[model samples]
Target: MLQTEFPFTLPCGYVDARGNLHRQGTMRLATALDEIEPLQDARVRANEAYLTILVLSRVVTRLGDLHPVDVRVIEGLFSADLAYLQRLYVQINEVGTTLFETQCPRCGLRFSLDLTEGGDINDASAGL
Candidate 1:
């Protein structure tokens, strides 16, 4: 979360019997909601990318966004919440079509998962 509050102080131009200007500091609070436009835009873009993947995978054909089929596809793979899925989508977009290396826990063979637009499986022997 981001803090959006700031404070300011100003001296009063009027003087008392002592001929001294009075100074006071004022406190105010501003919510980040007013500055969330860019974050909201980014979230919308992430959702769009997730929906595109759903469409490509035939999870939904006609809807502008995810449908029951898409939900089913997601549920089939991971039982995660919408926020988690959105974050995952954003991370995947950031990774952007590269071969990421990982070792198989079961066989101890090093493999690479291509983070491409379409999932591509490469053999561990490829050494990519």
Candidate 2:
């Protein structure tokens, strides 16, 4: 079955007003409206970069104890955490699968590979 939501652990996590750390969360697959409606938001209009904030707020279903993650919650996220979520969003929505860590047997180096891209895994590594 296709997965609609993904669980994640923030690298830096979001700190609430009470000094609570929210490291774990779940983000649902974004709908067309989630992507489109954010474009009309005044905040996004004022700052093109704010689009990520809005889009994330809509797709994130839960964060720690927070039930309905909103723009404020997203804005509170540390830069590292925000970047992590952004990468996660793209992986699930665009790539259709989460990245898996693999070790190169010959080189003995660790790397991540997107298995859903099809073709030979070696061919995919060539482009990396």
Best by TM-score: 2
User: Which ranges of candidate 2 are over 4 A from the true structure?
Assistant: 95-128
Tens-digit lDDT string for candidate 2 (1-128): 77788777676788899999987789999899999998998988899999999999999999999989988999988888898788778877985454643455577554565556463344324544
Let me know the TM-score candidate 1 reaches against the reference structure: 0.24
For candidate 2, which ten residues in a row score worst on lDDT? 119-128
Q: Tens digit of lDDT per residue, candidate 1, span 1-128? A: 52222111121222334554422211122123423433445544677444433422231221222232243443333223233333323333332436544455577565557756697878757754
Q: Write down the lDDT that model 2 would get.
A: 0.80
Deviating ranges (above 4 Å) for candidate 1: 1-97
Best by lDDT: 2
> TM-scores, in order shown?
0.24, 0.77
C-alpha positional error of residue 30 in candidate 2 after TM-score superposition, expressed in Å: 0.7
